[model samples]
Target: MTNEELQTLVKTISIDVFKKPFLHQAKHNPRLRTTGGRYMLADHTIEINPLVFKVHGMDELVGVIKHELCHYHLHLEGKGYRHRDEDFRKLLNETSSPRFCKPLAAQNKKSTSFYIYECESCKLKYKRKRRVNVQKYRCGKCAGAISIQINK
Candidate 1:
């Protein structure tokens, strides 16, 4: 959604859940890598990760907005606003906001290891993560001698 839309949503959520008005800005921040949303203590503005909407959908986006709003309202009212604060925790529970943001799907990709080997007799394909000596290791399917292949 656009920044204007985000601003409107934040304002609506603030009043609906916290019974307070949010007079600060709310905008999509593409630079936000891990966090779903962040509340700026100095400026009271809220920055939301655009990927949250794309990856997790509107419900997650609303939850994140609520989470940040907890910080926003609490900080504005001179109450405990940090994650460890009792006031913050209580507000979170009252509003049903998530304690922590959900992990991004893009950050969940697995890393894989690649290894290469060759058959001594037929020069067949082989791949492994650990090295195997030709004298001790043989191809299981063909029972052929195995050798490591280094690529230049």
Candidate 2:
């Protein structure tokens, strides 16, 4: 959805779920990588990852908006707004909003190649994402020297 639509949805959800108006901006932020949405304490703006709607659909989008609104409303009211706050948790339960968004499908896929290391004495094998210094590290099984093979 466009930023205009997002702003309207956030405003509507704010009033409907929290009985408060969202007086700040709500926009799609393509730069948000690890979070579904973030409520900016500095500007009181709510930024949602566009991928949430595109990948997870409208229900997920609404849930994310509700989560961000929880932070927005609580902070504005001078109540605890952090995720660990009692006020935030209570508000989330009252609104029935999700505590966390589901993982993206793309993020769930692992395409990583691993470096395989083998012990010289025990033949124990290890897998690591990055190259390991075989000379410095020894096998836990037999304290033997290790060798690295090209990533698979």
Candidate 3:
């Protein structure tokens, strides 16, 4: 969505959910790598990760908006707005906003060990992140026995 649309959405959500009008800007930020959205303490602006709508769909986008709104409203009122604060937690629960955003699908990478297996009879290769029992796992190419060729 364009920045203008985002601004409208944030404003609407603020009034609809919190009974407060959001006066600051809300914009899509492509540079946000690890968060779905963030509330700017300096400007009261909200920057949403563009990937939130593209990857998580509208429901998730709204959740992120609500979450940021919680921060925005609470901070403006001089209430505790940090995640660990009681007032922040209370507002989040009252608004039914998510405590934390679901991780974006695109960033959920796990570091793993690589295991390469080769079939003894067909020479078929298989790459797996976790080790497999060679005795239990066989090659699909020829129903042949498999052995690990490399581990890294």
Please report, in order, the local distance difference test score of every candidate based on alpha carbons.
Answer: 0.89, 0.91, 0.92
TM-scores of the candidates in the order shown: 0.71, 0.81, 0.71
RMSD of each: 7.0, 2.5, 8.4
Off-target runs (Cα >4 Å) in candidate 2 are 108-112, 119-128, 138-145, 149-151
Q: Can you write out model 1's per-residue Cα lDDT over 1-152, one digit (the tens) per residue? A: 89999999999998988888999899999998989999998898899999999989999999999999999888888999999999999989989999988897656645466568888788787876666676887887789888778632
Task: Kindly report which residue pairs in candidate 3 clash with one another.
Answer: none
Candidate 3 regions exceeding 4 Å error are 106-152
For model 3, state the Cα shift of residue 27 in Å.
0.5
Cand. 3 TM to true fold: 0.71
- The weakest ten consecutive residues by lDDT in model 3 span 104-113
In order of listing, the candidates' clash counts read 0, 0, 0
Angstrom error at residue 140, model 3: 45
Candidate 2 residue 42 Cα shift, in angstroms, is 0.7
Question: Candidate 3 residues 1-152, lDDT tens each?
Answer: 89999989999999999999999889999998888999999998899999989988899999999999999999999999999999999999999999877888655567777999999998988999888999997789899999999998
lDDT of predicted model 1:
0.89
